[model samples]
Target: MSKSIHKPGFVLGDALDIPTFKVLKQDGTLYKGAQEPEFDKEMALKLYDDLVFIRVLDERMVGAQRQGRIPFYLASLGEEAASVGSAGALKPQDMIFAQYREQGALRHRGFTVDQFMDQCFSNDRDLGKGRQMPIHYGSKALNYNTISSPLGTQIPQAAGYAYGQKLDGLDACTICYFGEGAASEGDFHAGLNMAAVLKCPTIFLCRNNGYAISTPSAEQFSGDGVASRGIGYGIATLRVDGNDLLAVYAATAAARAYALEHNAPVLIEAMSYRLGAHSTSDDPTGYRSKDEEAQWAKKDPILRYKHWLTQKDWWSDEQEKTLYAEHRANILAAMKAAEKRPVPTIDHLITDVYDEPTPHLRQQLKQLKAHMRKYPEQYPKTSGRLDA
Candidate 1:
């Protein structure tokens, strides 16, 4: 039973007709009737290597957190293709605003092992002066905004930054990364609406990883996942297989092109899963069964990429072994060196915030020093920093 219908203001068909974008399948095969996006051998190798590096980073850091070596950690795990692929699509000068778990993006932008470890260890040399938690990576050269802990705060900020970029008349755009968990926040709606109305050049990349902490996606939203919501807000939206790195890269590259040409916003929903616990503080086994976890393990992005790379003669098992060992050794050595580095000096705390420490600010610093001195044994590592 079909009937003619129309809304005066609406032009597109119903939401269900809107396509979900994808390029690869779980068996390391292409879609039956779809053509794969073309990429040269060198570029494909670069993407594959970045995925391997990030997977190693996530694996080792989770172990470090378990051993009480770091305060906290988040795993990108199954979502590597989404972050790395999207970041790979952006120009070096483009800005990146990320929620936690987008470490892959930082690594892709050439953030070093020492830089990552310095942030984790709160070392004096850390760019943020160790103010942020581990995995909250940002780099000035990379133009990646420092990650904020509050959920969805970056969403609206991304829109405003994109607007500013447009005013500057630059071809650059802003890409903000968030999880499905962050999509639940009020700021997500506000950010999308603002970007739409203002026609800001922002790309909202949502890593819909199927869980918000222990809560499953089925329990989180009754509507069709995050994609439908982006369409509702009148933004051009696409959903790609998050594990399919090629698809994500293709989609993001196209989105980047559109945003640059039109100064408009685009929403990308990358459908992936959390291959590890939510964080060091979480226990997924408590809420979800191990069998479910086992299923996702088979779809690991690293393995999928390795299959395709080997199929294309771009990689070998021996090369994979060498690469993993190299990154693992580098990360361990860097972490040890970074941990032993001294904490940020007392003056660094206030220098970046104000022209000079005011009378009241100076007094507060004095009080902080006094407290540290009063409890030297317990605050030994603090070294007069208030945050410690």
Candidate 2:
């Protein structure tokens, strides 16, 4: 009889698996053997500020969606540590392919409040030219790919891009963020296999948010957790406490080193939960209990991290109050202004693809314009940026 050999310390299906490292507890006490981040007081304060800003942004945008100010929104409520911590460990030149919920990464990378509002409002100044639905963000300078609605497509794209980085022999790696729910898709399998075979320098970050829409993680798979899938693909992998920012930062920092040095993909499974609905369109209450939601809320990323900072004598209640107020005011002011701004220029509809608009494209634009003019009252407001 052949006995199955499992790696030492690699526990499958546990909320904590693989590296499963944690630096701080919920009360902000350090677990023995964990090292604190090498952050000065100024930088630490800025990091806390970013968390506050991201929370406010998510909160306001969700309200916008509910009030019909925007068409849709996806809040990254409880998963901020995974998003922000992973992005924090990377150089800005590294690429990111986010699955729509990692806006905290963008916030940490210095994306302007104006820029966010522009996309949400579909304003003329929006970089995407109002083409994407709200929250679909990208910037060439930032090296972030524009968001896509299809699940798991970015997983393979990330592997392919990382393969290019490997061939180019660049120091930069690619980070692709997706939910554990996304790991269930076929593309997730294909991406991992390609990355393993090609030895691409990629960090596949799976935020196991305990739900695929409203369905619980218990309903998603039979195996322990998403971490098992990474080892199955033969890639180096780590699992971390997603609510513990320090743990996430430390793990991702190590993961980056392993990926960059080897030019081989690494998978990180961050155990966390979504404290909000899947989207503005979803209702989690039907499938999840209030007690469950309350339990996850108690493990809030911002709070836990704040407590850690305080434990180190780096933060205070006064500072937290000040940061929250600033973020709230800034979000409200920017959003109101954005909502009143005009939509993207009509000429943009036929530009950007070629030196000159093609005959077929021009024909389509003309037809669209005619339809708009025909129902001037119906199409009164300039149609918010056309989807390319």
Candidate 3:
């Protein structure tokens, strides 16, 4: 007898029309029947403060980059709610693996303005020992993993880390932040599948800002979005208006609860648009029209949240003005201090990699120092300070 089998049919249709979860409207009013997150006044104020600080920091750093203070910079820009709002929903003990844009999350978790400046300037006080590029932030104490420049690499790493958390019986989960563009990589599939199969508690947060550098989302994928991909992998998923802070907080809080209770992974697709260039190196005007940007600017996340706070009697216009002035001065002072600090010593190049430097490594360092001496004038003032 011939071995015959019938293949099941799958239909390609809009069966899963994922709705965007939104609490706060563009006019800053809560939608009827939409419940607010369980956040107190103190937490609400802090979240709003983070949103403002990140915005001001981005504006200042971009100017700094143009002035040749920093080599490269990527701003969170219009996606502050997607970073700080979601971060605020989680406990500090939970691990965060970020794409370079989630600096607001770091700030929300106690990464100070001075610490940010130190890292950006690559000074001696920088946690990365001046090895990584500016904005590649990391903090073990805050449970935020060091950001790697390679895209989508953290997806698999987050799955593995969350699996270890599951085995260790820890009460925390891992949250991985990435762009919709990174979802195009194979690591995304591998990581989500691993988390699904292993039942790891990981929250995959995709900031779908409509562009992966210069490529638009339409050119990147034909699917509904990142949330649909999560459903395909048998993971719980959500799509939210990334500009609405309350919506992000509510969705993330619920997602975290489900992940921890069920020991499963979740995906959150934040639908927001980047209000600035992708980076200092990118000119978004070349690909996106100014009219399109102007349209999104009308839905500014910070303004929307500020309006909400004012409506709740938690903030006022005078307070906003005072806060902005104070933040600008503080940031300016921090940057100046960071610029004056020396860079890490040359010995830091090989110290963190291993417990002890091998013969070959020591030889390489010696060679590097001799080369630096030969080209002393070419090196920066900080680079010449071997004892730094």
Query: Residue 102: error of model 1 in Å?
Result: 0.8
Model 2 CA lDDT for position 386? 38
Residue pairs that clash (backbone atoms under 3 angstroms), model 1? none
Candidate 3 per-residue lDDT over residues 240-286, each given as its tens digit: 99999999999999999999999999999999999999999999999
Clashing pairs in 2: 13-224
- lDDT to native, each model: 0.87, 0.87, 0.94
User: Candidate 1, residues 1-388: lDDT per residue as tens digits?
Assistant: 7467775555443446656677777666778776666678887888887888888888888889889999899988888999888988999879999999888888889998888889988889899987778877778888999998889999999999999999999989999999998999999999999999999999999999999999899898877788888888989899888888888999999999999998999999998989888988898889888898899889888788778778777889899899999999999999889988888877676676888778888887888788778888987776545554
For each candidate, give its TM-score against the true structure: 0.93, 0.93, 0.97
Worst lDDT 10-window in candidate 1: 7-16
Stretches of model 1 off by over 4 angstroms after superposition:
1-18, 383-388
For model 2, residues 296-316, the per-residue Cα lDDT tens digits are 899998999898888889888
Clashes of 1: 0
- What is the lDDT for 249 in model 3? 95
Which parts of model 2 have CA positions greater than 4 angstroms off?
Answer: 1-19, 354-356, 383-388
228 Cα displacement, candidate 2 (Å): 0.9
* Candidate 3 C-alpha error for residue 377, in Å: 1.5
For residue 129, give model 1's deviation from the true position in Å: 0.4
